[model samples]
Target: MTIHFSCTQCGKCCHNLRLPLSLDEAADWIRRGGDIELFCEAIPWPVEPPQSDAQAAHKRRLSFAAMCGAVPIRVIVTVVAAFDGACPHLLHDGRCGAYGQRPRVCRIYPAEVNPFIHLTPASKACPPDAWTTDKPVFFANGQTLDSETSELISQSRAVAAQDAQLKERLCAYLDVHHMALANEGFAIHKRAPDVMLAALERLKHDRKQVAHGAAATWRFVSNRLSTVDTLVSIGADTAEVSSLPNALVSYIAFFPSDV
Candidate 1:
């Protein structure tokens, strides 16, 4: 089976969403003088609510204590564009300003990178006209779809593995249990820039120390997660809506599934 694709560069894909970044890509963006807080957000792993009525009732009972207590907790770190609007790196002409240094997700666009799934035109983001049941189906870069998809799946796995390792260390450092789920949801647009800036610093410091003293450096990562926990706790306790951190607002809103 062969599928063809060509990015028209219409920029339809660049607007109205966050672009995910790997840890390395994010650090490089920060180092390039990008305002990490203004442009980036850390999205925690998402949790799915119970589907059955009885399970929902049980969940409600568990949530009677506090709203934040009901949040499905996880240790994954995924950075994304901070705004609900277009990406800041996107140029007015529908081209990426940081094209050379774009994130892996962007690089693998319109391709299904999940190893468990087979790539088909129906499963990709490309327009109907972008594909054909023809010979010599070429990706945007001229590589055959088979070749590109294989490479992308391999790359995605490596990146996912790195993220998982980081999540493990972060969870251990914070004394939190790890739960795996397909992370989803948009990061809050407005947040305390200082909070994220401090976290970025600690992340960089910890990454450097990982080669020599991983366990010792994990304390810094633990402190960052502790801050997020404290903020969420405060937001859950307060009735004053304005007092909640933007991230907490999004996190709590995701529960019960219907909202």
Candidate 2:
């Protein structure tokens, strides 16, 4: 069934709402000279420590939690401006200040035309006669909608794929490191141990799997090694540890000596 919708310019959708944005939407908002900062905040995800006692629990937490949780497929990381009470951009005259060039999200208010999902908020904020909800509807203000829609779908898919790949790599790294530490104890105040060598080898292999080029590999390997270097500099390995490596050594240093 063909359906249409018209926005009543009520500020209900703009106030106390967390609107997710796509890459295109974010770009459009930036072009409109919108205060992007007001739209988004970095929300930290909850994390549980890795199962392995030897694993760097905090280090693996971010990547591990991300992998286990669902990544929003089309929701690109962008500033989502919402007013503390009502949107600051909303004017006392019952209109948006940047109506002509508002964010793509704003332009499509109350009508989610994207095929993957639909969003509908109640009509309480609008005047009693200004809007209707008798039926589910989606409205886009454009001609040649098919072509534009196709292009947008394609671009959103590409972006989703890239984010998936990055999340996969990070998860794999955490998974491998966690496995290496299982059932193994590492000394914090000792030189590299044999087990440490094994852990390093596993970590290096994981890096090589993700990093293709020599330069890329070098950068990745060096960054991983730098953590060890920092630990060693801080006297994490004052004595020789035959089975524990620098990572394990560093992990131990953070615990109380009684432990």
Candidate 3:
């Protein structure tokens, strides 16, 4: 299905929005003379570690499976800080300061909802205020995923850069958790911190034995990354479509058989 909508530049989409950046994206912002601190406002949330050996094995496999697909996934969650009082780069007059080079997350606003059986009212309304939709979009009623909308919302190179950043962050997050597993009274296993750390380090080292170079890098390197599942889970959805305003505006499915 196709969706159609145009932006009137009402600036509503700019409010209460948290545009996250991958490490590369943030770095690029700095390189381009944008404030690095401004891009650092988005907070990273913790991902719980596997509880047991069996679970760890299972999760490891899952992580690999999840990463197999090529579709880029990244989360630019809306945190209070990022949305504190309108983005610093957002002009007082409603224009984005970094329009020509705005972050990927911000560029994808309004068209950012996920694929779900059910959608909240808040989720439905967010897009229409600054844009429109035309597909069987769950969040926005009567909206269809029309070609025009799709064209406007198509992914860009900057978004790909953000995806790479997400990978770096995830690696770092796992490393920190691996360390925490060594605590003496750590609730997970009551294991001694030093002992567990030693064992984990060994395991980490062994996993690097040429055979699993990619997996090894994933474990040893600290990185940032994003995925559609994680992004949709964290972002807020408008409950219903807001009235048309003077503004500009902006999924996926199971695998299909080859023809």
Candidate 4:
């Protein structure tokens, strides 16, 4: 069945949501002078039941925490930032501050795209009156997306999948284990942008180095490094560890583990 939607510019969708971002997008946001931590969050990979013995073995081999059911079956990190009650980019007049530069997910809004669903109206989040079955159907842009919606949805799905794959590759390269999401209501520090930026750069450099086998000996050495040392090398301030909130500390502590 065909769906119809038109954004009222009420700004409801911009509030109280987790905005997931790709690595490049996060970097771009930082470059744009945006407060990365205030609007972004890092989510660890989710735990899922093993689909096969092989998959279960892979998970177990990745970390002892997984074997003990403390870690997720997959080992990738996702970046998401909280919007609290309203997006910081939402202007006072109900307009987006970064309208032109908004993420692809925002551009495709009211239309859902994920691993299980694609090109469907997000009925629950959308206002009732925003959708209609009569007359011509319109999208957020006030244009008919009937023919283009499918392609847009496909592209969005592809991008999301690509981001996940990249994260997985990075995790494999770095031999990461036991990554975990922070508690939903955890407080983020003002210095989150600095910490995340440093982490991102370290991941990028380490991934490249590992790819070329820069130091076969170093890989073995890195495996022996403690979580604190790993965090410090990745630009996390060990000195500030004592001052960080409990949630952040717990999340960081899950980074290093052995199967």
The root-mean-square deviation over C-alpha atoms between each candidate and the true structure, in angstroms, is 10.4, 16.9, 17.6, 10.2
Per-residue lDDT, model 1, residue 55, is: 41
Question: Which one is best on lDDT?
Answer: 4
Q: Which candidate number maximizes TM-score?
A: 4
Off by over 4 Å in 1: 30-75, 120-125, 138-149, 168-198, 208-249, 252-259
Off by over 4 Å in 3: 1-4, 30-81, 117-259
- In the range 1-259, model 4's lDDT, one tens digit per residue, is 5566666677788888667666666666665565543221222234544667664543333222212132123322445555578777889998999898877667767666553343445544667666776524644343336566557667765655555544544333333322322322222323456666665666556544423421111111111235335444654322222333344322233234331
Instruction: Estimate, for each residue in 151-191, the C-alpha lDDT of model 3 and write its tens digit.
Output: 43344333443343333333332231110101110111112
Question: What pairs collide in candidate 4?
Answer: 40-81, 41-80, 41-81, 64-258, 64-259
lDDT of 3: 0.34
Q: Each model's TM-score?
A: 0.54, 0.35, 0.38, 0.55
lDDT of 1 at 174: 32
How many clashes (backbone atoms < 3 Å, residues ≥3 apart in a chain or on different chains) does model 1 have? Answer: 0
Minimal lDDT window, size 10, model 1: 214-223
Q: Rate the local accuracy (lDDT) of all candidates.
A: 0.45, 0.35, 0.34, 0.48
For model 3, the run of ten residues with the poorest summed lDDT: 179-188
